[model samples]
Target: MNIVVIDYGSGNLRSAAKAFAHAADEAGMAAEVLVSADPARILAADRLVLPGQGAFADCRAGLDGADGLAEALTEAVTTRGTPFFGICVGMQLLATSGFEHRVTPGLDWIGGRVEALAPSDPALKIPHMGWNALDFEPGRHPVLAGVEPGAHVYFVHSYAMTVDDPAHLLATADYGGRVTAIVGRDNLIGTQFHPEKSQAVGQRLIAGFLRWRP
Candidate 1:
């Protein structure tokens, strides 16, 4: 199977690529993990991963900047229904819109809005950095397979996705309040935290994604 990590010039591409490679190796899955913006390669992918960093507007712009890349991705993921994964700002881009830096439009794959994290406790800091425990919903998504509740994942974001439908929320974390950690529907999955940086939990998540059928 061919897995493509969409490089839109905004993410920690090397680390993500390494993690996927490691996961595929450990799982003994015959998969080739590639990092590219080439439309043909993206269209030929069996699975697609979109990883992003920096601001919403900047990431969106970088994704759109590539020639026919966005269209190719839409065709691969939306039309063909290839399994999709989004990480960090990549996950935020799945929302309908993001309120970071003057409200930018996103891929709108998931029905949600990305807004600044408003912690109930004033002592909690913004960006929500460091590791946090995940409170995953029971038996809803395959991506959480073998992943236990209270599993710690690394997060570093100032904003979080507020999903329109409760069913779309796969996992959450406590950051002075309930923070969206994971979201998934059908073949699409997203993580607000960096699974690559979450140690064993992150590696397991990567393996799960690699083996996930949908």
Candidate 2:
């Protein structure tokens, strides 16, 4: 199977590829992972994985100049019905717009704003990092089947998705208040947390994505 990870000059591409490679190996599936900025390559992908780091607004800007990448991605996922998996700031880009810096608009596939997780507890940190449990909401799909409600997944982000629709949210993590950790709407799946850094639970999540079919 072919999985294309979009390299938009935003984050570390190899790490995401390594994680997918490991998951595919464990799942006994022969998979080829490619990190390409070419829009044609991205459009032809069976599965599209968008992994990102750095500022949300900046990432959006980079994608905007990616020579039809933004349009291709939208068509690939929406029209051609290709499964999309997004990570970290990549997940936030799936929303309508983000308020990280100067209110940048996203792909608008899901309606939400990327906001900082509120810190009610004085002892809590701002950017929720390290290992945290994923609390599965309800109505589990194949992409999240074996992953239990309270499974720990690695995360490192300052902004979290404030999704409008409850049906889009698959799981949440307790940063301070319920911060969106995972979102799955139709063929699109997005994770605010980094599955690459998230060990076994993360691997299983990736495995599920490979096996998941709509």
Candidate 3:
């Protein structure tokens, strides 16, 4: 499969690319990992991976004004039903808005806001970094096929998504309280955790994404 990794000028594209490449190799699938800012290249791919880091506002600004790149992506994923996946800040961008510094509007593909993960305890860290266990919601989804409920995945985010439709949420994690970790609806899937950095479990998740069907 041809996997196009979107390079929107602010993301851990290299790590994501490496992870997908390694997973595809192990899974015996022909996958081409490309870091392209060009929207056409992204549109041409069988599947697209959107990876992100840094500020939400900056990333949104970069993506929105990407000289047709963002528009093409929205069309490809939302309109044409091309498979799309978002990671970390990329997942944040999928929300309706975010309040990091100010209220920044997001892609709004899913109805939600990227809000800070409020710890149930006062002493818990803000970013909620390190290995955290995922609680995948009951039922089947190709991306979480081999991934277990309560399985640990790497996480590093101060902000987390709160999707309006509970049906859109595929998985959650308990940091201090229940935290949304993975989301899937139709052809789109997103994760706040870093599968690329999650080692074996991470590879399995990516492989499942590769194996996902509409």
How does each model score on lDDT?
Answer: 0.90, 0.88, 0.88
Candidate 1, residues 1-214: lDDT per residue as tens digits? 8989998898699898888888888888888989999999999998898888899999999999999999999999999989999999999999999999788999998999999999999999987999999997657577788789998899999999999999899999999999999998888999999988988899889888878886
Best candidate, lDDT:
1
* Candidate 3 lDDT tens digits, 105-202: 99888889888789989999888999989887545587898888878999999988999999888898898888989887889889999999999999
* Model 1 poorest ten-residue lDDT run: 137-146
Candidate 3 residue 15 C-alpha distance from true site, Å: 0.9
Residue 193's lDDT in candidate 1: 97
TM-score of 3: 0.97
Which residue segments of model 2 deviate by more than 4 Å? 137-139
Q: Which residues of candidate 1, in runs, are more than 4 Å off?
A: none
Candidate with better lDDT, 1 vs 2: 1
Q: Is candidate 1 or candidate 2 better by TM-score?
A: 1
Residue 168 local lDDT, model 3: 88
